[model samples]
Target: METHKSLSPDPNPAAEDDDHPAARRIHRLALHLNPPQGLHSHGDLRMLACAAKGKQLDVSTQELTEYMRGKHRDVQERVYEYFNSRPDLQTPIEISKDEHRELCMRQLLGLVREAGIRPFRYVAEDPFKYFAIAEAVGSVDMSLGIKMGVQYSLWGGSVINLGTKKHRDKYFEGIDNLEYPGCFAMTELHHGSNVQGLQTTATFDPLTDEFVIDTPNDGAIKWWIGNAAVHGKFATVFAKLLLPTHDIKGIADMGVHAFIVPIRDLKTHKTLPGIEINDCGHKVGLNGVDNGALRFRSVRIPRDNLLNRFGDVSRDGKYTSSLPSINKRFAATLGELVGGRVGLGYSSVGVLKIAVTIAIRYSLLRQQFGPPKQPEVSILDYQSHQHKLMPMLASTYAFHFATLHLVEKYSEMKKSHDEQLVGDVHALSAGLKAYVTSFTAKSLSICREACGGHGYAAVNRFGSLRNDHDIFQTFEGDNTVLLQQVAGDLLKQYQQKFQGGTFAVTWNYLRESMNAYLSQPNPVTSRWESEDHLRDPKFQLDAFRYRTSRLLQSAAMRLRKHSKTLGSFGAWNRCLNHLLTLAESHIESVILEKFIEAIKRYILVSALEGGSFAIHKLTEYLSFQVRNIARELVDAFDLPDHVTRAPIGMQSTVEAYSQYTQYAGF
Candidate 1:
């Protein structure tokens, strides 16, 4: 062996140039290792047997679970346990769409009737009650999740939010008890995102004291309506309310309004006269949902069937509404349905939790190629796998909190009916629904890829989970349209900041951000990379806020500049991409702020080696933190075995191999 004294002196080329003592110490470590004259004999280098107990952290997974649960634990746990215990839910998805649909329906009816959990009643009393149930069901099966949403959130929620006391008195009990299986008819073939342009007509009739619901063209047919193909007996149909007039224009278009149109007979379950329904057929995912298309051929609904809370038709065939404009009425109607987006966002976050949990747990159990003469190590020990999963885990935690906040805002808005709060929650829900669902859709595919070939197996759930979640991006509202709505709201706030309009609590950040935007970041901030600085919550928040404000201001300027020549809509069209980027940036800022508010400090950092800077000490500290806290943090997600359902994601290697062998039919 080479003697220490005969070894080369420090290869510290930067030793002379470096000023910091730590920098010099790191440089000297460069010469600390030396190779032997020849490879060591097997006897000399062979591993020694010893008891090396794994280190444990002081973190409590239970406490973290409680934190994640917030005030909704009991409700969620009830729902989670219900599905987990049911052997019916544990079965594979090898069944037909009809079987899947019937199974989903069975699960839904059991939840409501057998479990005696009326999520509909909780819609007004406590929104989290319903939200918790929705999220829990979503984690187990996205198809069942969508079925529940269609039944409870969309159909039941529309009645509660948009209908008057009389309308409620007539339908609420039936909707609550599953006596009325209903679907929402909002998205038409031609106009999904633009509810204002929906072509279906609900013409008032003075003689009959009814409204004639008619699809003017094939494009006006209600498409992708859940529960309509096999189960739904009624629909909360959205159509243009046309009232007969004595003037030049024979009728007045009352924009879009909701009416309870009976799509099927409660007894026979037959499609009603003049109402046509066809199955949307097989989908790329969410096949368990019986999605269908509906076309109305002058379907007659009683005048009382109109959900008259927002806009009403009287016996005299006159259109009456408290909202002053057609636009305000439409806004009010959709505002009530914001709960759909809220529930969707919350459920999407839960789906992501399942994916991240499965991916991380499997990564821990999986062993792959190793260095020469060493045993295979857990995939999670590899930096590539960590990079794939840790950020996703972090974001899931953030989204969990942020989506809960949206629920809170929505609940408060519904109760108070505060106009400003309503606007804030609408925009917030829309942006979050778009951003979170898009992320989950993309992250599912990534999680699939991360697990390698095993992820390809349907039993492992990544393929099915990803496919089911893919539709979340376009349903409720298309992501592109939703983001534009958010950007429009942001610009409205920006203008309000100048027009002397008082900022609501939510938009107040915009005013402060605008002020901060006038000044540039200091040189230190511009070049900030210190470990402490990077981890500081204040620094992270300020950076996000500044980025959002800068985007908002710049996007506004671009629109203004283009408007000089192109006109308003043309200018908006020209700046569409920039506006979308601004919308997403704003949403990211909000999510980051919420996450920072809820979390305590702990993170890892990476750096590229370069000019004589001292980072080794910092790097070592971060490495130790990862080994200490990373595993426990992931464990805190605490997905039940049924939820994960992956062979390699189980607790022990035996369990994994057994499950894999069983799955392989060996």
Candidate 2:
């Protein structure tokens, strides 16, 4: 394979000191590249830090650009050299006729194992791990495919295991060990997100003690399933379970049930008698995964194959569920999707980190304008450049902090079986996933643009990163759809408060609504004298604490008022835009609040570092940089300064002092 040369190391020794201009620039760049260390525990922080180091954490963006242009071919050559030196890994086992399929799967899985990363790490690393892996393999198509497959299996397997112990036992180990590569096939061509409308059926065959699975028509065929085209041996297929005596052919008496259906003959490596498989041809991104369509024609599996945690079947063809209501049962199945959404949100945060790291490093090294009497100036020094980049940097910090909070909430909810908490997590994940991924996509594009012509090249990282992130807007769940789900939940909460509910709840709702209103520019501010209170940082932070409350109330009120004239869909659609607005505002408020809280915590560490102005400024800059670095930094670093402020600050000073003393005479 072809490789590019590496950039020569900077020869100027004075540039390494903290007080030097280059040192200051490097410090700023490092903040973006690595972020704060305390957001997460030290172990995770170390792992991410190690990964960043492996990627040559200090490489200048201009150097990266030059490397991309083959001006410094050795840089690219070194990248490939590092990748190739690693032990070859196995891909997930596949039974395709093509030998390369097996070879590729083995290689892919080997890479994951060699990285010593869990599948969930992909969520934390977002687009970077995938992009890097792709670059290693010399194919973006393969990278995208493998990413989707990894995500699909990891997220899907987690949900399956959590929701049903039986499904977990039957499939979890196989999935994790790469024994039975599978797909979570829920999307049908006719009904993508509308799960209730799926036409595929799993009829109880009491005589044979089997579930007769059938995709009766073209529309019912499962499409867009990762691994289904080649690698997948089985699928956790969702179908409307048909009741024998109800005379309702397409109706689901027990809601949607998952069945572990074997699509290919294990021994023969061929499609089963009644199953049809078709590969989804190349798409915009993520091509390494074999996304395929599957159609079942009277496919049959043993009755035990039904993943019936929420619902079950009797030998006499009777349908039953622990949850009597079909809606609730259906919800039990769909609810697991929240985990996937959460994982995706985390992935978006990772993507943002990589983008920011690239942009910040590029900003520091790339010189643009000449001084009136001299030479070029660093683009990073320009106010406009900082303006374009800083807010995004701030927002990334916001995204990271918010993501950590969400993950904590998710972990808590997972540990407990509280339906209410789960629902809240569901709404939060969906809203945040939509908001963060969309923002990350936009931010990455901005970073790319900020890097100018060089950003377009694959080697500089932006172009490929952008391509890798493109699916974030749609995958896991469509951003708009997720926003609507958040809106729906908000509306439900609002209605409870609208009925003269508890003072605490009502006050919360009122507070949140006011915050939402304030977030938007309004001309009629004089109507409320308390509006001035909104400007207070403390008050703003408090308002943020309850950001979702009022939007839900407003949406509920609007829906209720419009319900008389507009049908449910029409009323929802009419208020949908408003609901989405509320969701976005609510999510943003949470992010802003988290950012402030994180900053406060960091500031405390700074204060304890002693009252020196320079120390304080350094702390402030570092805190903001942590915010800029956001989630990934949180994953890798610990808040050591807060607990050991004196020692930590002393250590930092000693390190700087040592460096200065060493170079004093030079």
For each of the candidates, give the backbone clash count.
0, 28
How many clashes in candidate 1?
A: 0
lDDT of 1 by residue, 415-518 (tens): 89999898889899999999999999989988888889988888888888888988889988899999999999888888888887777666667877677754
TM-score for candidate 2, residues paired by index: 0.70
Q: By TM-score, how accurate is candidate 1?
A: 0.88
> Each prediction's TM-score against the native?
0.88, 0.70
lDDT of each: 0.78, 0.58
The CA-based lDDT of model 1 is what? Answer: 0.78
Model 2, 1-666: lDDT tens per residue? 111111112233234443475543444444334433432236445445534643221223343233222232333243334344542432222223344445556555654455333343332223233223332333222343344444443434533542467665666655655566677888898888788888889988778999999998899989888778887788888888876674646444565778878887777778888889998877665545567899998898998888777777878877766686878877766665565666667657656765666566556556788679787876766646765665665566567667766766666665675676767777788888999989988888898888787666554556656765787788677999988887766565555544644322212434345445435423121111221233334555444434455556567778888888997888988988888888897777667666666656644222111111111113233333333333233222121221111111122333533433343353
Pick the lDDT winner: 1
